[model samples]
Target: MKNEQIVLAQRPEGLPGDETFRYEDTEIKKPDNDEVLIESVYISVDPYMRGRMNDTKSYSKPFEIDEPLNGHVVGKIVESNHENFSEGDVVTGGLPWKKFNTVSSDAVNKVPSTEVPLHLYLSTLGMPGHTAYGGLLEIGKPEEGETVVVSAASGAVGSVVGQIAKIKGAKVVGIAGGDEKVNYLTETLGFDEGIDYKKDNFSEKLAEAVPDGIDVYFENVGGPISDEVFNHLNTFARVPVCGAISSYNSKEDNGPRVQQKLIKSQALMQGFLVAQFQDNAKNASEQLAKWVQEGKIKSEVTIAEGFDQLPEAFRNLFTGDNFGKQVVKVSNSLD
Candidate 1:
């Protein structure tokens, strides 16, 4: 059998374009001891992946030019040399962007038997969900009756963060780019108020939404949106820095310095990675799953069909073309 893979053609300076990716086909390799062969079902395309495309040092190692790109993937085991896995066992892990992957069994986690769609394992029940759960609960720590503001609130992590805050008895205000997404947050996601940052009077609307001032700010898209939020922060506010998608493609990141705002409010601002809370991953998953099953939390996914759509799916993240978690449906899972 042959496997097709997407590789990083070169390091991108600004936004990655057509020339950044290349496709190649090669013979599928057999799994050795304690390894399994997986056929991908759903592949995740996330904002953090853009950081990896840069050659600069960071939490994740930069993707080497000409090497196959890798991220979270939901797949089914086709062949297994590992005692723990069997043919057709669904799993999720960090794997190369390929039609098929031969990897160590230890690298993947078996998807629990649940009615939730397998694609969700690459979204809400996966990294995005985990990131929202850990970051908000650990750092934001919204209290009952407090006000919580989440930027890019219609996107994967921010969407989850808003709902969780609502569940915790806080007034949730979501900030997005358009009226459609703003409506999704207020009408569908149950947020108290939705602010469209692209509006001419965005700052004025944001000020009106959080009358009591923002107690917790789930920072996703930074730049001007974040500056407006900072202006309305109450004393002792908590800010969990998730990502700054606004600056991801910029040649130079120029934004307001927020040290004075932090000092005046005495707010706590911390940046985090999901792996920092690895010890409580199972507990977080169990809690999130329970919330999801009980309808206390809802997950939304925007899917692009075919493995060929991977690059486009990834590009959609920065473009706001995706409403929720953006995933590529590479193939069908085993029945």
Candidate 2:
């Protein structure tokens, strides 16, 4: 069988386009001992992958030019040479964007039997959900009656952060780009308030929403929105720095100094990667899954149709072209 794979053509200088990706056809390799052959089903596209496209140093190694790009992928085992897996087992892992992948079984995790959709393993039930649960609860530490603000509130990570905060009894305010997204935050996700950052009077609206001052800020889209949010921080407030999608494509991200705000509020600001809390992965996943099962948390996703849509789906992360978790459905057979 011939396998189709997507590779990084070149390091991106700015916003990546079709020129950044290349497609190739190759013969599918059978799994060896302790290995499995995975048929790609759902692929996740995230903002952090943008940093990997640049040849810069990051928490994860940069993708080399001409190598097949990889991310969180959900797949089905078509062949297995391992004792732990079978011919039709479902799995997910950081796998290459290919029609078929042959890798050691140790690298992938089997999907638990659940009533939720399989695509969710690449979305809320996967990496993005873990990022939210770990970052917000560990760093943000929101308290009852306190105000919590989440930028990009309708997104995969931010939406979960908002709902979890609400479950903790904190008043949650969500900041998003348009009226439609803002409505999703308040009406659908149960956020206490939603602010449209695209409005010229965003700062004024943000101030009005958090009258008691922000006790926790789940920073996602850092830029002018965060600069304004800082000005509303309560004393001893906590800021969990998760991502900065606004500056992902920029050569340099310049903004107003935040030293004065931090000093005056005596707040704590910390940047974290979900991997840092690996020890708590099981606990976090269990709690998130329970919340989801109880209808306390809802999964929001924008799924693209085919494997060919991967590049466009990835570009959508930067353009805000997608809502919730962005994933591409490579096959329907798994469903």
Candidate 3:
């Protein structure tokens, strides 16, 4: 049967535009022995995809021009030749942006229960959620009553990081782009304080929010926000650098220089790519899932309909136009 796919039309010069990708139809053969055929239900659009658009060296290889773009997908097995996966079983895995995928049975993990929406597996129970859990606990090591700040606090990873910090008894503050996002962070997400970086008095607001000084900075949006947070960090503060969405669309690689602050405060600043902690995902997922079940954490997702909206949904992440995990629903099983 034929499937629709989005291909990397060209390597983006800086930020990707419409010309960078092309949507086309292709045919896929039935599953081979020990393989499964999947129909995608939802696909994730993430900030890290921007880095993959450039033909530069990174922890993950860049998507080659003319190749189908791949990311986390939640799908249902329509055909299976493997013992592990059965037809009609819902699963989650890495798959290209397409209507269907032919993959090895081992590549798909069965969804635990239908009680939780399948789309949740593509966000809170998926790579982005695990990144927040492991990156914060392992790298940030936040303590009770300590002050913690996170940029892009309304986005996927940042939102989860802040909620988890609060669960751990920290005074959590979030930095976001607009008033709507700031409101969601403070009112919905249970953050102690929310600062709108777009405001003229952002730096002053941040200083007021973090009165005790930041003990942990779970940095997602870098550039000036990170610089200002760095300056406010107390001695021995920990900075878990997860992503830099603020600079994803920039032509130049300029960010706030805070080396002196790091030196003076004796803070620990470390960057981490989630893939590096694949071995710990299982443990982290269990913990995060438990927290969700116990009402200790909450997650939000911004969903767009159809696979055709993939490009626009992805662009929204870099533009700071989306709140929480940006996802595209490919099909309506309930309908």
Candidate 4:
């Protein structure tokens, strides 16, 4: 049978442009011993993919030129050579960007028949969820009555971080790119206040939003917003660096100096990779599933239809065009 996929045609210099990717169709053999043939249902589009486009050193190796990009994908088993998995079992795993994948049985994790949708496995109950859980709890360690702030507050990780803070009894503030995202953060996500970074008085507005001074700043969209937030951090504040989506596409490094604040405030700042807490993912997933069931954590997914929309869907992350976890629906079971 034939499978269509998106491959990295060239290493991007700064931000990835359309020229960096190519779509191709090729033939694949049926599943062999201990393998399963999966028809992809949904694929994730995340800011971390931007780092993979560069040939520099990172947590994961850069994608080889001319190879298919890989990310979290949810699919159903159409053919199986293992006893544990059967036809029609929905699964999630790190799969190549393709219409179908032939993977070893050990490569994928079986999804439970929960009330949460399968797409949640690639978003809220998946890596981004764990990123928020481990980073905030382990690093930020926000306490009740403390002020907690997060950037990219409308995004998958930041949205979850803010809500988790609120659940912990902390006053939560959010910062997003535009008014729409700001509204979503304050209104839908239950943040106490939301700041639009696009506003002319962003720094001033951020100051006004957090009157008590930030006790914990969950850093996601770094750059100028991060710089402004740093200045308002209270003494002995904690900053957990999860991601920096705002600077992912920057041609050059730029941000306000924060060394003085770091010294005076005696604050703790740490950057973490999610894989470092792999030992806790299973436990975290279970807890997140419980939260979802109880309506404590709400997931927002922006789905683009078809495999052909992958490139545009990915590009949307850099422009703040996506409202939440951006996913591409490759093939629908409902259809």
Which TM-score value belongs to model 2? 0.99
How far out, in Å, is residue 5 in model 2?
0.5
lDDT of each: 0.92, 0.92, 0.87, 0.89
lDDT tens string, model 4, 1-335? 88898999998876677898999998675899999999899999888998988888988998888899999998989999999999988899999998999999999988875456878888889889999999998899999999999988888899999988988999999988888889888778889999888989998888898888999999998887788899888999999998888788887767777788989999999999899889988888888888888888987889999998998999998888898889999998624
Tens digits of per-residue lDDT, candidate 3, 84-127, equal 88788889888888899998999889977776766778777888
Question: Candidates' TM-scores?
Answer: 0.99, 0.99, 0.97, 0.97
Alpha-carbon runs more than 4 Å astray in model 4: none
| lDDT over C-alpha atoms for residue 26 of model 1 | 77
160, model 2: CA deviation in Å?
Answer: 0.2
Cα lDDT for residue 317, model 3? 87
Candidate 2 backbone collisions, by pair:
none
Report, for all candidates in order, the number of backbone clashes: 0, 0, 0, 0
- Supply the global lDDT for candidate 2: 0.92
Measured over all alpha carbons after superposition, the RMSD of each candidate to the real structure, in angstroms, is 0.9, 0.8, 1.2, 1.2
